[model samples]
Target: MPNQTTFTIKLETELKDAFTKIAETEHCSVSQVMRDLMQQYIERHEYKHFLEDKVTSARASIANGQSIPHQDAKAIFKTRREKV
Candidate 1:
């Protein structure tokens, strides 16, 4: 299990009321809904970082002449698909 901590925030009453109503309709507690939203936000940010890192690595590899030509890669994949 992960260590749990409390987070505090202030928002308009109307926003809070709307969010609480949605959570209730979904059969979730307000805390659980907030936690789920936080987790989704974290995952989205982390995935963006992951994509940036991959793009950086790919650019470096291309600059170093370590990548195959596009047409060659496409041909290789075509052959692979035919084999499969």
Candidate 2:
């Protein structure tokens, strides 16, 4: 395992109690639950930005008339599958 770092965090009583209950139900420590939740939150935010960039690029492409027809897309996929 990589080296671990420690930091102090404060949570509301109700939120702390809720996390404790979930940790108990999941057979894990509260710290583990918080760590997993934070990891998932970070990944989700990253993916959101990634998708936003893709959408922005696609919109620019459409505005510039750089697009393929639906049938053309289907034919391209069919040819790719056949090649594979």
**Candidate 2 lDDT, tens digit per residue, 1-84?**
498988678989998888799799989997887788899999999999999999999999989999998899999999999999
* TM values, all candidates: 0.91, 0.72
TM accuracy, model 1: 0.91
* Regions more than 4 Å wrong, model 1: none
Compute the lDDT for candidate 1: 0.96
Error of 2 at 52 (Å): 0.7
Q: Can you write out model 1's per-residue Cα lDDT over 1-84, one digit (the tens) per residue?
A: 399888899999999999999999999999999888999999999999999999999999999999999999999999999999
Compute the lDDT of residue 55 as modeled in candidate 2: 100
List ranges where model 2 is wrong by over 4 Å: 69-84
Candidate 1 Cα deviation (angstroms), residue 41? 1.0
